[model samples]
Target: GKFPEISLDDYECVMAQVERQYNIRCYNLYRTYRTTKVRPIHVAPEDWQWLIDNLWSDEQFQKRSKQNSINKSKQEMKSLVGTINIETYEVTLVRNPETGAWPSAVDVWRAIYMKANGTWSIPNGAEILNNLEEAAETHKERIAAAPIPLAEHFALVLGRKPNHSRGVGIGAVNQGAQERYRIRARAEAADQRASDAQNQAAALLEEVERLT
Candidate 1:
């Protein structure tokens, strides 16, 4: 039977929204689906069962669950942004008039923190500020490249290993696509260099033939 098609990005977005709405973690989404006994119209009965058998009960899935828990614990930056979606928050935020790009994650956090605590400076904020200060001194060129680092760019500023999403909460679902684009860009650049080298060689041969 034909089922409605959904792109992977769309599917992941839907799942993320569902998780946020229900206050359920991503790992526990399978359990929620199983408990509710609710299935999407597109999912066939057998396919749904396959998810339960192959994913819900799989050893690899369990391993990921454990890893996700560990990742959650390693998260040092807490936010006061609450349940507000990042995209929605961006609308109220001031963006660059020229580029129209949203502010950096650090700036966003500072704004949110200020709103909640009446100041950007928290009790232990000195520690974080000192770290950023040292990082800027040591990695001058790195900071110059990203004046306003958004999403995964915080990994560099915060000195923390990136989580699965390379972000704090409800990150963009197309992270995999972004990484793929980077890889493709590098490959294309390499191919272009090779082509340029071949063209240079061909031109040199033509000059030699004319001279000879």
Candidate 2:
């Protein structure tokens, strides 16, 4: 009888399966399982640790993974009050009642502190947070009252439509917007084809049932 110590290749193979099954990085699978003491629904509970230990030394056992497409959509969402600074690592909010969408932390922080009244001092973080929370509630209520349909809402969430907190259907196509929109179109067409296929299958089954 022989027990096999997992090779790096085997560890990678399992991580690939975990990624395919759960749509997550191997690192996340390891961390979540360790911290929560709960089995990830997408991965086998038994081998999680073994995979973690074996794969930890690999350079690609990344600490932070790329934001997946869905999270990218969420990050682009305007309902979120503030953004994480990619460079200087500051969290900032937009206070302009006119524009709810502020994409850059440095620009916003400058507008509020550096140049607004020729003062180089920034306001307290809590003040900004409170202001945005109020604005967020108002925005939520307004969007709720708008005439957007459920189907259109799904499109917005999926990046089929542009990320618009203030305006719906405003997909100001960036450099790759056309490509993404095309992909969305293809996916929609595929979904329709799937529905048609399901219907045909059901009808065929019903006809067979009748014949028998």
What is the Cα-based lDDT of residue 196 in candidate 2?
Answer: 100
lDDT of 1 by residue, 15-95 (tens): 665765675543455755757867666667897778777777888977887786676555434446443333345446654
Q: Residues 20-134, candidate 2: write the lDDT tens digits.
A: 5585465466557557857677777557656756764445644333234334444332222343322112123323557743333234433434544554443443354344445
TM-score attained by model 2: 0.26
TM-score for each predicted model, relative to the true structure = 0.45, 0.26
Best by lDDT: 1
TM-score of 1: 0.45
Cα shift from native, residue 132, model 2 (Å): 19
The clash numbers for all candidates, in the given order, read 0, 0
CA error at residue 76 for candidate 2, angstroms = 7.0
Instruction: Name the candidate that leads on TM-score.
Output: 1
Candidate 1: stretches off by over 4 Å: 1-31, 34-42, 72-76, 83-94, 98-106, 120-123, 130-139, 146-157, 162-212
Q: Residue pairs in steric clash, candidate 1?
A: none
Off by over 4 Å in 2: 1-28, 57-178, 186-212
**Candidate models: Cα lDDT each:** 0.56, 0.44
